[model samples]
Each structure stands twice: as structure tokens, then as C-alpha cells.
Target: MKQELRKQFGDEFQYEIALNGNEALEVVDELVEAGVNVILILSDWLMPGLKGDEFLILIHAKYPNIRSILITGHVDESAAERVKREAGTYAVFSKPWDSTKLMEAVRICCNKN
Candidate 1:
């Protein structure tokens, strides 16, 4: 996924990947330290540490301006609704996502932010 994003964005955007929530938080700190405004997070639901929904909510609490998109292969309807209501994510795309749609959503999100 990281490689695909890099190819799609090239040098136009900065990309960072973390294995878990704590590492992701550290990356956020580093980006802030460098004066980068993180506009979006594309996350998956099932992770080793914090679940993706939980992780996104954590970030959102700290940085409400940063939009989020959840990409997951496994989640129930109730969970999806919870993300929409609580996390306030921009969108939730399932596995085997359409690349064009994802990019379009990203473009809209960036423009809005």
C-alpha cells in the first residue's frame, strides 16, 4: 500500500507509514516538529496494537483538522456506523478499493482542508 501510494503521488506528497499506534503518534510528532500539516490518514481496521478506528479517533482528538479515511477488509455495519458518528471520518473504503475513487476522495479532502 505504501509503495502504491508513493507511485500515485510521486514527489507531490509526503508519505509516512507506522506499524502501530504508538509509532504513528511518534511520526505525527516528527511531522509537527518539521512544521508539516498532516491533512489525511488512510488507515486499516485491524492492526496489531490499536484498532484502526481507535487509532484514528485518538489522532482526531488531538488534531481535529486532520481528516481520516478508513480502509478495512473486516468490519460490521455497526462498527462502520460508529466510525461515522464518533470518529467523523471523511470516508470508509473497503478492501479492493477503486484507486481512482480513493484518489478523488483524497483530492477533495485535501482541497477542503
Candidate 2:
């Protein structure tokens, strides 16, 4: 996915990766401290430590401006709905998502930011 993102976006945007929710939070804090204007997040619903929905909600509470897109291989409809309603997730994509649609969504979200 990272490779795909790099291929699509090139150097237009800076990309960061974290292994788990805790690491992702730390990375976000570091980026914020460095004055990085984080505009979007793409997270999987099933993660090691913190679930993606939970993580997105926490992030939304702290940084409402940061748009999120949730990707999941297996998640209940209610959980997806909860993320959209509570976290204001921009979109949710299942595994094996269409790259074109994902890229389009990212472009729209970035443009809005």
C-alpha cells in the first residue's frame, strides 16, 4: 500500500508509517510538534494494539481537521457506521480497493484541506 501511495503521489506529499496505534499516535504528536499540517490518515480497522475505529475517534477528537479513511478486510457494518458518524471518516474501503477511487478520495480530501 505504501508503495502504491508513493507511486501515485510521488513527492507531492510526505508519507509516514507506524506499526501500531500507539506508534501512530506518537508519530502524529511528533509531526504536530514539527508543525506538519497533517491532512489525512488511512488506517485499517483491525490493528495490533488499538483498533482503527478507536484510533480514528481519538484523533478526530484532538484534530478534527485531519480527515481519515478507514480500510478494513473484515469489519461489521455498525463499526464502519460508527467511525463515519463519530470520527467523521471521509471514506471506508474494503481490502482490494480500487486504487483509482482511493486516489480520487485522497485528492478531494487534500483539496478540501
Candidate 3:
């Protein structure tokens, strides 16, 4: 995924991939251990092992300061409602996303960090 993003966004953007939530959490923990403060998290909502919204919930519980954005290809109304009702997400984007707007949103959110 990062490879594709690199190809698409070039050197202006940085990216990292985590095969699962544990790995992602490890990376986040390590960054925190390094005394770095991160602000934005962009996650897919249908990951294996842990659902994306659930992962965001966990992250919110542990790191309430960070802002999270969730992307989902799923169109289930109930799931959307659940995410909106239960999670502290910055935004929920559906599949076939608008790259320009997404990057703009990232830039806006990242500027605060």
C-alpha cells in the first residue's frame, strides 16, 4: 500500500504499513517511546484480527490526543452508524475515495500536529 502511495504521491509523502493491529500498535508505541508526538492516523475499517473501528477505539482509549480517520469500502448503514456513534473518528471516507480531497484533509489535519 505504501509502495502504491509512493508511486502515486512521490517523495512528498511518507508512509508505513502494518500487517495487523499489534504491529501497528508496536510501531506507534516505539514512536512514542522515542519521544515523538504524532497526531493523525489513517486506517482501513476492514482489517483482519481487529476491525478498523475497534482498533481506533483501542487507540482512542490509550491515546486520546491523536486524531483518527477511517476508510471503508463497506456500505453497510449499520456499520457506518456504529462507527459514527461509538468511535471518535475525524472522518469516515468510503471506497473510491477522492485523492485530492483526501490529501487535502491529511494536510489540514497534519498541520495541527
Candidate 4:
């Protein structure tokens, strides 16, 4: 997925990867301190430490302007609804997602910011 994103967007955007939710938050803090405008986040539902929805909610609370896209192999309807409501999730994709749709969504989110 990372390779696909880079191939699709090239150097147009700076992409960062984190091993887990905590690391992701740290990266976000560093980027914020560096005056980077973090417009979007793409997260997996399952990861070490905080779950993706939980992490997105936390991020939304701290950085409301940031939009998020969630990729999950498994998530319940209620959880999806909650993230959409509380985290301002821009999109959600299931596992084995269509590359075209994912890229299109990314493009839309990037353009919005």
C-alpha cells in the first residue's frame, strides 16, 4: 500500500509511516512542531497500542482539521459509524481494496486540503 501511494502521488506529498498508534501520534507532534500542515491520515484498524478508530478519534479531538481514511479487515457497523461521527473519517476501505478507488479518495482528500 505504501508503494502504491508513493507511485500514485510521487513526491507531491510527504508520506510518513508509523509502526503503531503511539508512534503515529509522536510523528504527528513532530510534524506539527516542524510547521507541517498534516491534512490527512490513512490508518489500519488493527495495530499495536490504540485501535485505529480510537486513534483517529483522539487525533480528531486534537487536530480537527485533519481528515482520516481508515482501512480495516474487520470493523463493526457501530464502530464505523462512531468513527465517521467523531473522527471525521473521510473514507473507509476494506481489505483488498481497489487501488483506483483508494487513489481517487486520496486525490480528493488532498485537493480538499
Residue-level lDDT of model 1, residues 1-113, one tens digit each, is 77776776777778899988778878987897899989888888888888888888888888888888888898567777777778888888888888888887887887832
List candidate 1 stretches off by more than 4 Å.
none
Write down the TM-score of every candidate.
Answer: 0.89, 0.95, 0.78, 0.95
The deviation in Å at residue 39 for candidate 3 is 1.3
Model 1 Cα displacement at 48 (Å)? 0.7
Which ranking of candidates, highest TM-score first?
A: 4, 2, 1, 3
Enumerate residue pairs that collide in model 1: none
lDDT of 2: 0.91
- List, residue by residue over 40-93, the lDDT tens digit for candidate 3: 778888887888888877887788887777788986667666665666676778
Q: Which candidate, 1 or 4, has the higher TM-score?
A: 4
Model 3 lDDT on a 0 to 1 scale = 0.73
lDDT of each: 0.83, 0.91, 0.73, 0.91
Give the distance in Å from residue 81's predicted Cα in candidate 1 to where it truly belongs: 1.7
Candidate 2, residues 1-113, lDDT tens digits: the string is 78888887888889999888888989998998899999999999889999999999999999899999999999589999999999999899998899989988888888932
Model 4: per-residue Cα lDDT over 1-113, one tens digit each: 78998898788888999999999999998998899999899999899999999999999999999889999999577878899999999888988888899889998988932
| Local error of candidate 3 at residue 112 (angstroms) | 6.6
Those runs of model 3 whose alpha carbons end farther than 4 Å from true positions after fitting are 1-14
Candidate 1 global Cα RMSD: 1.9
